[model samples]
Target: MTEAGDDTWLARNRATLARLQFAPQARSVGRVEHVADGIALVSGLPEVRLNELLRFETGQLGFALTLDVEAIGVVLLDQSESICAGARVSGTGEVVRTPVGQGLLGRVVDPLGRPLDRDEALGETVFMPVERAAPAIIERDPVSEPLATGILLIDALFAIGRGQRELIIGDRATGKTSIAVDTIVNQKDSDVICVYVAIGQRATAVQRVIDAVRRHGAPERCVFVVAPAAAPAGLQWIAPFAGMTIAEYFRDQGRHALLVIDDLTRHAATHRELALLTREPPGREAYPGDIFYLHARLLERAAKLSGELGGGSVTALPIAETDAGNLSAYIPTNLISITDGQIVLDAGLFAANQRPAVDVGLSVSRVGGKAQTAALRHASGRLRLDYSQFQELEMFTRFGGITDARISAQIVRGQRIRALIRQARFAPLPESVEVALLGALADGLFDALPPACIATARERLLAGAISGDEAAAVRARLDGIVQDLTREAGHRPSDGASAP
Candidate 1:
């Protein structure tokens, strides 16, 4: 067509679209030709766009995932058992969206933004699209400030930053969700809002998580987006994006938000199922090759916006499950490359009674010292390396070889440090408290304590430091602890070698 003719045709089409958009009840109806595995192929919904929702004659909802020459593939968002062939379907001309605003806080909602909690009637509905383009690189700022997960070991070593995308990858039951949950619990006093997206999880398990957040007194600052096991695969696939969109709303409003995708392994599996149903070409492990892009786009939404805009951020803590701790598997490896870093958990450490089971050697934070408080930064200077050395030496000494005094003392210090990091669930320590304990350790204060009694001594001393005023007794005890450390470090041991 000639340029003028093309422009004229486009103008006419734009006018027609405008009219259709403003017209009331301008719905295009279609008929379901086939229904299987929660997906329906409709033959007459020609006006439907990709990802557009449709309403059936039976009032069920779906979205157009594929549009072929003769049929449109619709993924049902609800139960499909009642839906069958020859059912009428009408295009709603709207994409899926979720409720987003201050009102959504403390509410447990499904992917479609329906209130799952008794107290939430979805007041002040400000809905936003579940899929949004990530902020551009220029709109982003450096992630320097700490998110303060309140776990001493993580805060001291593998610090997470606001607007950073960090993956938590490990085998099942290896404390991945626990870390995310603990981080949410730790945000009780902060201005940060939290969105917990539970995809493909059991209803009882989701309830337990909700209860834990409630018990931590942080429910008011958190939103729950759950697509339980009973939900359709489509809902499970959209749940994380819905949660991300909610967090984006808060970020755009000049508030910080944290999003926890409980685990993307199941999310990926759901997407794989949908892709298979839609007849897409499956790649490795039967997952579509675009799976990497799926996660990358989602994680890219986590950015520290520049000061010119609202200095808000959406920090993503995406969890992924590894089969038998095989992180080299396709999905886990894909996530590892997409995120800034990962917190690796070890089942061996879990069996050894480590609460978090964080494998220090494997876990790393690219943000590093910049994401840590100065006090924590100073206190944690040599903690990781020292701990690694201690582990090596202890393992070496197990062969019943020579026992150097330096190695023995180092092992003792490592034992004390390990005990120091053992924390109970829901007990997220404050930054100051962590700094004090770690600083005391850095100052050689805890090495003199008995290894088995390290936890008790730390609690007593920390309690004295936190609640007990600068009393003479507290000061004297602290001083005595420091003196003992000095004595332990300086004492000449019989047949002693150089200190490690």
Candidate 2:
């Protein structure tokens, strides 16, 4: 029960109970009660929205209010009782929750956190609250640990740490959803629970995602929330928050949680629509003046709480699709500034057949240092510099025969490195495999293999045929041999004696 404030908004209306329900029902409007300046009340109503209050289904008889009073309290009408003259209704601003434990997996849900499939009923469960304030500074733990996505290239560069908020911004068809889903599937052994909230997406798209997640055998560890296109606009506004509430329950219980908001752009648009409907002042792009506050509060809830509070943390990967691939757009820029870092997906590179066409030069991880382990940082230290130099000289060499043996050798090695970074299908790589693969590439192991053999060589590494220490030795020797071959291509005289 919510206590009344000094000034409450209430409405008084005499109407019949449209349906039998608890206080909180999604998109349902109750009848108006007594109207005060800010507080209104019908007999026996809660202070919160009817959809929000219906979570508690009391068998007690009462009236119902349908629409929000734009301020406070609701009005209920009881036909049996003659109290219809005027009565006070109250609302408790809360959401229903599902209990933690076994069997929550393999479930599809709506924004209200209720099962969409009516065939299976959710038994008595603990109620999780949805509207929560941002976490306090004292509750936060600095993000220092890495959350390996098992995608070799991403793990090697631009590492995403647990409890970090990362924005995956890209144009349409850039494989953003695939990356998020793949991350969820790959986290099976990491002991990290995944919550995927789909807002304002097509039912077909949502169905495909569910099928893929189940196919990966991650249903037990994954929680999926969907707000279909046909659902009330308000559901889309509240979907991400509802998903966060569920993730927070696990986090508070000292379990790692991963929440992916498929596309915040749609969520923001819906919010703008609601605000405009509510007659709020529109600012940039017709968004409310509090747009920053709206998003910031939502995202700030994602944090690594202190062990003293609850060591469990939430790592959020919020995907945003840019309109026309513009990063300068209002929402994109705002998100970029708020997040710990962003993975910018390049449409141009994607068009060039580069799977996960991440623009190495443009895509960056600002908080990557926090996530990078000492060994990882040391081993891949020179990668950035080397790639930059190689790319600078690449165009000139493309003209054919304008390069010396040394320059040509560098190009060959760099090409091998780029190919090594190409992503494979969603498969988890053991730390040892990643270390060996990256170590060998840094030392130029793939230089001798034909470009066609890149896939085979990577497979061999994954198979553990070569250890990390041996990778450097073998790679150096292979690079030396490739340089020798390039020299032989020009028929240059050997400066040193041939090996026995």
Candidate 3:
């Protein structure tokens, strides 16, 4: 019996050995023609698709960006110092993709889907191509839901609709990134997923943003995709695309998303550098002729999907830095045209210590009126008009004292509204609180109060605590007060009587 069992085991082992002798073969390999400046010209990868992933014989990774007749120009995703001419390369037969899931939130990664925050790899998650086509017209629904920034002026006047592409254009150090950060902070506890892409930023600058995000308790809902300034141009160029791809993954899962590209101006410059290196013809600003399409394609992917398509959305807030407050610059102008609208941060206003510095005259939401809630719509009506008129008269009143009491009253009302718009950093107001305060302002709640004290009052109004079983009831009572005041303000007629 023992001899027979031994013979049977040997026969089974021999059968298993026979099966392993005839399995499928590995992928075909290619050779690199040249390597320089984070780009590799590789021959023998004619089968490689555009934007496909490539692997070097030495374990380096690159992306196939340009497909030429003789060779493929690949963008190295990692350090390229070790790669050399005539090095053997192999095709992964897949395009550049990044991980997407709840796991990605609270972690930091680069454009190539490599984790940077932890020593070990992230858990398994779905991977999506960095480049994907925008939804068709039939697949999209109109953007009607309001995406509140918790900033009074922006919500009251230039509302950012869900699924809208809003451009934040301003000069350097004018607090463009601050606006983005506050918006991200406001998403806390909300279902909206926030992805912040930092391209060509200093490592320390990116770290500061990371710290701020954590301190605000939004790391669970936020993902930071960074390609620091020290990284190669190719890495910087693909960072936003990777971030967007991750955002789209969440959108497809029927979740809303907000994506912030800290600045696309750097992205454009990096693309230009790659273009010139690849011998492409340069257009205006020494950028590639497709500079416009470069962003157009990326941004067009943002949309509100129809209900039949799971009713998800991805809103884009792409920031662009201008020189000397010039909106006519090539990059800013191009972005302005691509986005649904722009929020211009006036340097003059910023210099005056106007926090958030939004110039109402220049900041407009094309999706306007509809994007606002009923409470906001009622309170903000005629706000921009009154503020603009006040500014016009204030300039002339500088030459002489106000002779008319009417002009004096107008100046006083305008000052109050301006003070109300000034919000402190990291303190994003809740929707209920914002509505309450705006309604209060509309009802003359701050008329006699000093403008300097307005900020303090607004903070207390929002920060007051009410907890337990009575919290909901108390909030409803507060909301009722706000609604009544807003209603009263809407119907209240202006006093025509003038005082001497």
Candidate 4:
């Protein structure tokens, strides 16, 4: 009986084994011929594609940047110190991808989707390629809704719209980052998700931004992608792209998102370094000829989807640094041309005690009044024209005493306008409060009150309850509030002064 059972078991196992098939597979593996400066020259992976991920023997990762008949240029995403010449490199048959989804919210990460804030798992999520094509013209809808910055100047003048790419150009320390942070803080009660990518910034600086948003804004709705100055050039270069991919996930889900690339000047420099390292011919400013295309492709991804796609949008505010207010510089100009509009900050005005010194004449929104709220569009109709005229007249009056009563009164009104727009950092006005203040100024509500009184009135108005639905009601309530503040300050409003 035992012999019969053993024979039956062996026959069954042999039958199953005889039904199996075996096959041989081949992989394209290359060897690093040269390695240095976060780049490597590999020589045997003839089948490798451009931008495909590469795995090295040292457990480091890189991407094929330039493919040649003889060698492939690779950019290392991890530290290159461990990778040496003759190291084995294998093609992963995949491009660089990052984790994307709600799992990324409230977490700080690198360009590779690795968590940087804490040792928590990202949970189950989908991966998306960092580089993606922009939406076609037919797939995109017009940017009709406003993305409020809560800044009186930006809201009243250069109103930014959802799905728009607005460039923030300024000299160092002129409050470029501050403006972006304020915008994020202002979205505390909004449904829009925020993605802040800090490229080549200091550790402390990146920390400050995270702290500010956590303290003043809704941290639960934000994602911070940090590639500090000390990070590898490859990481910094990919930081913004990874962030855009993350934001795109939300937009695809029919939700709105905002992306802030803290500054791209460093990214351009990083590109130049890599270009020179890889022996690419240098163009203007020693950058590669494809620099413009590089950014254009990245920024063009920000768009408002058509209604059929769920009416979602991605608004991008990319910051660019200028040398001594030089907007004509290569990087700044490139960004200015790519964005829907540019918000130029003046260091001179900044030094003059005007915080967030936005150059109104130079800062223009191509979307213009179309993206503005009905109340703001109505209240600020003639404000810019009068303010520009006042600026010109005030400059002339500084040269000599003005005898004309009209010119003198114009200067007074211009001064009031300047004082009204002066805003402090971290204090963003709501849309309703902004409309109310602008309306009050348009109605000659602050002509006689001094600058100090105007500040006091603004603080009071900010504290008061205001609604954005009814502009006229808010303006009426603002009138009473301003009158009370002026009376408390022992000052009276002008009886017949015309609005600026």
Candidate 5:
């Protein structure tokens, strides 16, 4: 059909469509018939509703219709030749990509990068496709760069590097999301660009995240992409890609970007459902066998390409939620294998009120040593050996008094390691604090402090009141606290068989 003829046919079709009341297919696109003052209704579709997805042209522009369905009776937006009538309506062509450019900061966007909050219009975006090839191995630099999170457990023990794939696996309500959020907020002044992709989150939850991100005053440094629970399943599947595309814009300009796919469980689940609907073969739990491939491709996009190419990096922290804290499940294991390393959060530890309650003995950082400083690796490596031996012996000796002085000494060091890593916030620690905490634990500065006093000393150290040589002064005060506690117990080791 000629272009003018097509427009005439579409206009008639839209008139008939408005009178008919039928729900469109789950995945279809429609054109805006009219647009005025940032409000528009698409032609040939039932009045654009509050949550319906709509597109302009074949794929040039798209957004989730945010206006009330009742108010969209017959009015249409954009009377242009292409969007008039009989325009093809289907799911958004290709994944909804983020429009690259400045001012995307501080905006809460849907998977398609449309403004979710209606605060402002996105203008003049430099676009990039969602499905991008991983940078070639030769073009990529090694992950020898450290990205300090400021958490003792992570910085000193499980260091995360730029362009690294670190998995955050945990059961629900274990503060997994909190950890990711805190990390982003703490990067305000660190020159790190952060993108947080919320897949299948609640609308209220997305709002809260936007508020928190704004509160941090790093809107220019952060980009938030949200796919709420009620959005079409296809949107949820594409949310992470949208976030990554935004980060890639900055990284390509020689800037470092940190992309967090918080709770990829939802994305995985959505992909599984789509695979089934498309009649793909099912593997474990009816999930597609190629499930691993989907994740691997997405995560492989993160890399530190050499200066000859971009001189930038995109570090990925992808979180996966497991059932009942079971990492042996199908999805968790698939992700574990694809990523460089995993940070497994323990539910039992969380329940015990261990804020940021990571089970130190259980979590392993395959690339941790490579990402950390020489001093950190040396100190923490020894600390781990000491703590492991003490815990094994403590299990057998807990039934009686003072089994051995050597075992008692080890217990003190073990307790100190735990206390030092205990943090309530997800803020990344300064590099100096990371070194001091590891140094103190290695040197037995914590040997004398009681468990409670040890916790207090850790808080003081992180507060930055003590640093460099002054950290020793704080340790001296802790020594006094320990001596006072030990004196009250008097002659404890002398009477080996006595309980008190």
Candidate 6:
């Protein structure tokens, strides 16, 4: 047929089909047997599978959480008040999925990828299952590259690596979220995309985090996934998983990403609530037996891919809350065993005016110096040991016993280190500044000045230091800069002090 004739024929057929009424295919329909507290028991859909999405007559959504012989336990993603017994429910034949892509960056979304911050649509995203298999061991490379948190205590002492899962655990109100937010804020100048997942947090608290990142960090490079306290339990349960899937998209694209679960303790509570609602038997501490497995599977997705897989990575900072500084608690201990290391925050230290409140003795990074930058590793080799000893000696000195000159000097040096590492909420230092400060400490340049002067001198150094683009040149000039600052502060520079 001629081209015009063929087009006309196709148009005629399409118009004819549009006027015809067609019946929908027969789907396995079920009826809700019981409904309560965001969970429903459905019957007559024997083919329903776990994690499968279910549609209710009320236009609400749920997932098949437990498939029993007689009925399927569904966790509703919407308000359960609208759903009632005998409501028609049908399986979607598909697992729960969320939108993933670059379009999600800078957007505040829920666990289901619905935008919460604005009314605009998320443009051009691919839907991916929230639950995915973690990369196999062979597909992952060893984590060696540093992921700087910009907090001197972490970068210099407990170094985190790309693709490593670091746990931040502490009692309530001890700046746990502050550490995570500061880390996200520090990525303003890096290529790393950050995903902050607030699971079961207060609305005001979640808003505070969004505002902090907007003011101090590159919001365009971030994606906030929030399941606030008021959200449905099902959404809270999947918040971390959804955030991880979103971040994995960037990682698969050969880009670096960071995922922060702003606190998983509440997630655990939500899981327990849903499990109870579904009638699942509780285990330790009224939590389900699968609680550990749930988090492990989620965090294992964060890995450094091998060279053949584009060498991308996803670093995770999973926060957990402890009661009364009890590290022996069930959830805290499980997380401590799962992560590469735990950054333990001390409530005592926090109350004592330590801003980050990182407990040096308790916190550790298994990656250690392997993930530390060359400059930082060289300059901070002995810092942890010295500070540890200083803390011990200072505790003893509180009783006012006589001290030797060496002990006195060590105490003074330790106080300076403490002062130097005490950083403000939104201010993250560059590597060059951290190196300079640590190098000066090692050379005893701060010994001549009072501890109160260290903060002023640090501000001076950060304001006047050269760019970090030429690391070697910057390192070479650090000594001279330290000397000049010490001289300007009316303190003699340490004799023969050298740069890192």
Model 4 lDDT per residue over 345-450, tens place: 9999998988789998899899978899898898887888888999899788788889988877778778888888999978888787788788778878887677
Flag clash pairs in model 4.
none
Q: At residue 243, what lDDT does model 3 achieve?
A: 90
Best by TM-score: 4
* Model 2 poorest ten-residue lDDT run: 55-64
Question: For all the candidates, what are their Cα RMSDs to the real structure?
Answer: 8.8, 11.3, 4.7, 2.4, 11.5, 3.5
Q: Write the per-residue lDDT of candidate 2 for residues 210-298, one digit (tens) a residue.
A: 88888874787888888877766656767888888878888888888999998899988877776665456789999887777777888
Judged by TM-score relative to the true structure, which candidate is superior, 3 or 6?
Answer: 6
Q: Candidates sorted by TM-score, descending order?
A: 4, 6, 3, 1, 2, 5
Worst 10 residues of 4 by lDDT: 491-500
**Estimated TM-score for each candidate:** 0.89, 0.76, 0.90, 0.95, 0.75, 0.93
Error of 4 at 153 (Å): 0.6
The whole-model C-alpha lDDT of candidate 3 against the native structure comes to: 0.84
| Model 5 spans > 4 angstroms off | 1-96, 398-402, 426-428, 462-500
Which runs of model 6 end up more than 4 angstroms from their true locations?
1-11, 14-25, 469-493, 496-500
**Cα lDDT tens digits for candidate 5, 71-184:** 231212222334444445433334334577676776677766778777689766776666677888998998888877766676766788888888888988887877777777
How many pairs collide in each candidate, listed in order? 0, 42, 0, 0, 16, 0
Alpha-carbon RMSD, candidate 5: 11.5
Off by over 4 Å in 2: 1-103, 395-401, 404-406, 463-500
Model 4 regions lying over 4 Å from their true place: 1-20, 466-469, 496-500
Q: Give the worst 10-residue stretch by lDDT in candidate 5.
A: 491-500
lDDT against the true structure, each candidate:
0.85, 0.68, 0.84, 0.89, 0.69, 0.89
